[model samples]
Target chain A: MTLLSVSNLTKSFGGIVANDSVSFDLNEGDIYAVIGPNGAGKTTLFNLISGVLRPTSGSVQYAGRDITGLAQADIAALGVVRTYQLVQLFRQRTVEENVQIGFHLATRGGVGAALFRPGWVRRQERMVREKSRELLRLVGLESQAGLVADKLPYGQQRLLKIARAMAAGPKLLMLDEPAAGLDTQETSVLGDVIQRINDQGITIVLIEHDMNLVMRMATRITVLDFGKKIAEGTPVEVKVNPAVLAAYLGEAELE
Target chain B: MTLRSTISAKPQVWATALAIAVAVALLAYVFGRGGYVVTVMGFAVIYGVFVTGLNLFMGYAGQASFGQNAFAALGGYGTAVLCADYGLEPIVALVLSATLSAVIALIVGYPTLRLRGHYLAMATFALGLITYELSIEQSGLTRGFMGFSGIPPLGLGRFQLLSERAQLAVFILIMLLGVWVARRLRGSRFGRALLAIGESEPAANALGIQVFRYKLVAFVIAAVYASVAGSMFAHFVGYISPEVFGLSMVTLSFTMLYVGGIGTLWGPIAGAVLVSFLPQLLRGFRDMQDIIYCLALIVILIFVPKGLASLWSLAVRRSDVPAER
Candidate 1:
């Protein structure tokens, strides 16, 4: 069954089309990968699907519900969450605090209840705290949970962002360049974590320039070029498509 | 940890603050000799409350607001008109005025909070300007630049908080309450949401946080706090004036927020006490007081941009674990 479906989605920045007539379907429990060279609109497609940017035309359906043009937060509330290309951890907060913040939707109580310290709020808080620790362990940063978020090494910061994203309890987690700027060892660690996350029944959609990781981990792959879908199929089919290879090699070469 | 231990952490902070406030009050009563000292301390406490409110918006929510003084004016004028003109109970005046300020914040923040960065700052600054002008132009209601006077003292029945000692005690209680509220908020889910927004609005939105709604709530809460402080000021002084809540007051509150640190619960109080007394301490220096204050602020920003909390944390870190920078 399709977990997320986008049909002919188009986004324009004035006269420039960032995403043009893009269409794809993500199935439930599939580790889907989106790959393209620089400025091929991979990130823009993520933004449109994630509701950070509204499509000019067409629609996005998540679990048979139209989510097109919904506010980003509202989309997230419906269990569709995205991570940014750049790490966006809450820098001043501790690593665990960053993860706890990700549990915003799961937690309840407001300013008045918080001030009074009611039993329910305290219970919810404890649950979130324990869950945050569990997430840290998943990202292999459990020992660093007490440290400030930004103080983590760059590769660890990327994992921290994923841990925070998971705190939201997302059914569909869309990651933009999660493995960007990682060494071979770090990338392998990230791949292992991603596989574990996918094994747990959460659908994963990611935009990545790391071809090796994409080939090894993706159940299916979609290729985009200059805002249009060039190819979509299983990883093997996408890799051998003549149009996909020409688009990458002729102008924007994939590293 | 279990629920019992988790709940204990926040209360411990508030208990410590209460203990410190009581000790400080006792010390002042014993060592301080005159009404002037008490009045100064009272104003310092009031300003601390105001700055703490402002920090909730600017520091925690990651929004800049320059027109908090306008809300403070609304607060002062709200109480002044309700009590001095209509002869209502002073406590009633306080509640109504603060409500008025919050309603105005909701209306204004809806549009103004949408603008980010410097644009939001400019918009709030304009709001301050408009409020100041309205206070001056609306003569019948605000008494214009001539000032609104003869506000009844805040009290219960026949008893009033007129004496400096009584006012100081009341202000201390109120300030401690404000501190307690801020501390509780810092640990709350709402506070975490605000901090998330402050750190990254886009990330917060992606995490299912209603960014604008949270911002509006923070703006309104801060507005109400400013209004309450103004109400306290009006009843304490028995007067209200536009000049008292103008550009200079905005600058003063901003300085306090910075000197104390933006997000910490105790920063505002420490900053208010220190900055409020600096001029009095430097009385012999005459014009040099302003220069010294500016220099001290510069040093604080350059050396410890995180404010006094950073310094305190550094000390604590040094004593325990020799942590990495």
Candidate 2:
């Protein structure tokens, strides 16, 4: 099933076009990756789809609903969530607290219940706490749950962001540079986690600069250059596409 | 999360808190007779409640608001108009006035809170100025700068709380209630979301936490708190004045939050008590009182940047360490 469909999406900042006429279809249970050089507008595309930025023109259809200009929170409530490129997290909070905050969408208690602390609210809070812990374990940070988020190591901090995003119960998870700062071992672990998440029936879309990781992990690949789609196909097909070659290599490659 | 486990892990802290609360209550009852000292302490309790509400906005929810005192004025004036002019019961006036303040907050927050950082601060500052002007200019309603007097004391039909000790007792109870509410907020999902928004708004939004709605809720709750405190102040003093809820009160409340520590549970309480007593203590210094107070705050910030709460945490850490030979 086509879980997310982006058609003719265009975004411009004054004279600079960040994303121009970019279109793609992501199917359910597939790992899709978008790769381009620096300034290829990969991150901008993620922002546009996640409702952090509105496109100058075109539409984004998620689960058959046109969610072009919806608020970021509204879109996230609909199960489309994204992690940040720079590891945006609640730094003063514990790792578990970071995850629990992400459970805002799944949890049901409000300010009134928080003030009163009735039995039902306590029960719901307990459930959220347990779920947050389970997510920590899933991300292999169960022991670090008590440590403050900013105190975590660089690679672990990245995993914390992913764990937080997972706690949001995203149906379509868009990861921005999840492996940017990780070593080989950490990258492999992250790849395994991503595969596990995909196997659990969540669609995955990522913007990654690591070509080897993307080529090895992504089932389908979309290539962008200068704010436009150059080529897109299964990784094997995209590896041999002439347009992708020229975009990645040099224009002289075609000559 | 770790919050539940930490609460369970240190059950002894609750015992300490209970003991301290009891001791403070007993001391207040013993010494809070009708005198200048009791009056200062009474004002401390009132402002404690007021600053606790502001802390919820600035510390937890991460919105710096300057218009909180305006809500207090609304509360005081609401009670004055209802109780003194319309002859309604004082307690009913308090509740209605608090509600009116919250409604006004909701209406104002919708437009004003969209501005971020310093912009939001300036807008709320503007709100404070506007409300102050309104209170003075609307002479028929607010009685202009001459103020509203003869407001009835807080009490039920037959049991009017007449003495300073009686009023101090009520203020203490309300202050405790405000602290309790703040603690509850800090541990809940609502508070966690607010903290998340404070730390990074885009992160909170991506997680589907409704940032705007939560900010509005925090704003209104803080407004109601300030209103209740204001109403109680009016009833306690039997008068209302625009000068009571002006820029000076805003500075005092902000100072309290900072001096004690912005986000700590006991920061506002400690800040309120310490700052409220400074003027009285410095009375002999006369012209040097404000200067001394500012210098004290600077010293505290320099030595303990996190506010006085850091000292408590440092002591806790030391106590947790094993003794060496």
Candidate 3:
């Protein structure tokens, strides 16, 4: 079943068209990768779909409902959570606390309830502690849970971002360059972490510069060039597409 | 997470806090009426509540507000006018004043809070100054620089709370309750969401936290706290003037917040007590008091940059700190 569909998705920044008529659909339980060179409108496409930016003209459908132009928080509440390309962890917060904050949607309590901390709030907090600890263990940061988030190494911080986002109880996880600053060993570990999360039945969409990771993890690949979709298919087919080849290696690659 | 457990979830910290509270009460009792130390302590607790609210806005929520004094003035004036002029009960007057402050906070926060950064501070700065001006210029109602007096003592209907020691005790109780609320706020899902917003607005939004609503709510809550503190101040002195709730109040609260600790659970209380008494502590130096006080601030800022609230953690990095239940 189609979980998310972007139909005729277009976005323009003043006169510059950042994402020109981009369209894609992800099936339930499939890992989708959107790959492109720098300035290929990859992030722009993510922004439009995630409701961070309004499309000049287009629509984003999640679970068969139109979600374009909705608030970023509202989109996230519908289970379409995304991690930023750069690390955005709450730096002063401990690792476990960082992940617990991601449980904003999963837990229910407003300002009033937070003040008194009645029986229900305490019970809710106990569950939150257990659940957050479980997530920390998942990403293998449980030991460093007491350390402040910024105190972590860069690659581990990236992994921490994933753990935090996962705590949001996402149905569709959109990762923006999750492996950007990661070393080779860290990158491999992250790939495994992404796989483990995908196995838990959440659909994954990622934009990546690392072709190897993309080819290995992505069940489907969409190629973008100059704000337009050049080609899209399974990893094997996208690898051989001439337009994708020209876009990545320049048109001279064909010769 | 709330510093409540992260630092003081252990028994030692609890004992330290209880001992401090009891000592305060003891001192208040021994000092009796019109003692300088007791007066300073009483004022400290009032400012503690005000700064506690400010901490929620600036420390936990990660927003700025220069106009909190505006709300304080509102509470002070509201209580004064309602109790003194209209013959309303002091308790009812205080509640009414706080409610009015909340409404004003909502009105101011709605637009300024939408945009991130210190825009709220800019708006609040104007508000604080404007409120100060109104108190001076509205001579017909407020009596201008002559000050507003004859505000009734706080009580339940016919019962009057007139004793100096009793008032100090009540101040301590209310201050403790305010700290408890702030600690509860810092440790909950709501608290986590707020700190998340303070750290990274975009990331927080992508995680399903409503940044605008939360900021606005934080702003209003802080204002209500300021309002209540102002009302108490009015009743404590039985008079109030425009001079009390000016930019100086903002400066005082800011100093208290940083000196005590910006984000920690006990920061406000620690800061209020210490900063309130710092001037008095140096009074023995007479001619050098101001110089010594400024030097003390600089030294503390350099050596204990996190403020006195963090002193306990350094003193006892105790193990087996039970998780907050």
Question: Predictions ranked by lDDT, top down?
Answer: 2, 3, 1
- Please give the clash total of every predicted structure, in order: 0, 0, 0
In the order shown, the chain A TM-scores of the predictions are 0.96, 0.96, 0.97
* lDDT digits (tens) for residues B180-284 of candidate 2: 999899889898888888888877876777899999999999999999999988988998889988999999998888888888777787788888888888888
Q: Report chain B TM per candidate.
A: 0.89, 0.90, 0.90
Higher-lDDT candidate of 1 and 3:
3
Error of 3 at A83 (Å): 1.3
Per-residue lDDT over B1-325 for candidate 1, one digit per residue giving the tens place of the 0 to 100 score: 4332254556545655764786577446633676666677778888988988998998889899999998999989988898878878878888998898999999999999999999999999999999999999999899899999998877876778777678777877888898888878888899999999999887787677889999999999999989989988998888888899999988988888878777777777777877787677777778787798788789887987776655545543432211111
Give the DockQ ranking, best first: 3, 2, 1
Q: For residues A79-198, write the lDDT of model 3, one tens digit per residue.
A: 998988754788878888888888888889897888777899889889888888888888888888887787899889998999888888899999999888778899999999899999
What is the TM-score of candidate 1? Answer: 0.88
> Residue B302 of model 3: what lDDT?
89
Q: What residue pairs are clashing in model 1?
A: none
Measured against the true two-chain complex, the DockQ scores of the candidates, in the order shown, are 0.49, 0.52, 0.56
Q: TM-score: which candidate is best?
A: 3
- The better candidate by TM-score, 2 or 3, is 3
Error of 3 at A17 (Å): 3.3
Lowest lDDT block of 10, candidate 3 chain A: A85-94
- For model 2, what is the alpha-carbon lDDT of residue B127? 92
Q: Which residue pairs in candidate 2 have backbone atoms (N, alpha carbon, C) closer than 3 angstroms, thus clashing?
A: none
What are the per-residue Cα lDDT tens digits for candidate 1 across A1-255? 999999999999999888889888999999999998789888889888888788899999999999999987788888887898854778877788899898988677888887988888889888988898889989899887767787889889998899888988889999899888999888999999999889889999999999999999999999988888899999889988988888888845643
